[model samples]
Target: MSDLTRRAVIGASATGLAATVVAVGPPATAAPAPAAAVQPVTRGAALYRRGRFAKRRTRAFWVAGPGVRLSMKLVAVTDLSSGGARGSLRSFELTFRARRRGPEQGTYTVSRSQFAATSLFLVPTDASRRTYRAVVNNR
Candidate 1:
């Protein structure tokens, strides 16, 4: 074959090889994302029969002594009864207790829930019995 023809054939073959290399190249593969952790929930009659007991957490506290300070925590507010207007938290009760206290003459304040906005003032009614009365004022 002529030199010019041979050179032309070689150039065409190089171009075809370049095209084939590009077509057969491996595609990009994305890395798999990590799996999320899942938490299991209790179900069945315990959910319906227990009702609030199933979803709500019950807390208790005891106070003794003359001068003692106590605090209550507002955990969560849930609808006690169902099948009412949506976005209404009815039959909701605040859960809290005075922190344990020993005999002493002192006064403490209880923080109210955001929704209810109540203020409770605790005062020792009896010095000997170490008993207190919580005065609740709903704002």
Candidate 2:
């Protein structure tokens, strides 16, 4: 009705809202800190060290892609390092076996327990045997 009455009503409404918010209190916990962003492993030679995979001899690599969820076994891990002009040696190869002869040559997200997920360009060396190879050469 009057300005004074309107002001009084507005003040009461504001105070009520503030009280309701305070009663609710903060969240039980701080959300959960989102989730630590996981940086995909990019360095192939570093991540898939020959020594590490060679010893396991039974590593399982899960390939993630559109309409593709394949579990390939790590059949072999070869060391293809050679002496360069400067005597630098950095090269290795990983051989994986799949159940079917598909998922041709392309970049796939491969994941294993030894390291984080990484994008590896895979090439099908033998379609009949369902084998894939990924050569990691670091200069």
Candidate 3:
């Protein structure tokens, strides 16, 4: 064979071998999605205390403007009282669970500064439920 033709044949064979090795290798596995960062927060506390706890989920602006985004928050409140309080001032140790979804388009974020008050909300009882749902179009 001519020197140039032999070199070209060798190069083509090497490329074909590399391609076959890649194709025959174990199937590529997709990376697992990262876990979402979450922090439970108190919502509509004062109103709740005054016997005005919103029982249903909150819906955001759909009619206000050409909303690119609509957000809703549902904070399920439960009275964890087993019996009457021993003292005159009756107050049960309260826990909060907050779930917020839909804020702008690509991403949703909430910082501590936005909240009026924040503390470590421990919920061993699992008294609240949080959820998020998205669809391509209104349904």
TM-scores for all candidates: the values are 0.22, 0.56, 0.22
Off-target runs (Cα >4 Å) in candidate 1 are 1-69, 81-91, 101-109, 112-117, 120-139
lDDT of model number 1: 0.38
In order of TM-score, best first, we have: 2, 3, 1
Write the number of the candidate with greater lDDT, choosing between 1 and 3. Answer: 1
Please give the distance, in angstroms, between residue 78's alpha carbon in candidate 1 and its true position after superposition.
1.7
Largest TM-score belongs to which candidate? 2
- Per-residue lDDT for 1-139 in model 2, tens only? 6567888999999999999999999877645433333323466455655565566567777976656679998898776535423322345777888887658687777887766777777888974747988876665
Q: Report the number of the highest-lDDT candidate.
A: 2
- Give me the overall lDDT of model 2: 0.71
Lowest-lDDT window of 10 residues in candidate 2? Answer: 81-90
Write model 1 residue lDDT over 49-128, tens digit each, in one string.
22332143443233222243344333333443334333332223333333343334333333223321223333444544
TM-score of 2: 0.56
Residue 126 in model 3: lDDT: 34
For each of the candidates, the C-alpha root-mean-square deviation to the true structure, in angstroms, is: 17.6, 9.4, 15.1
Write down the RMSD of candidate 3 (Cα, Å): 15.1
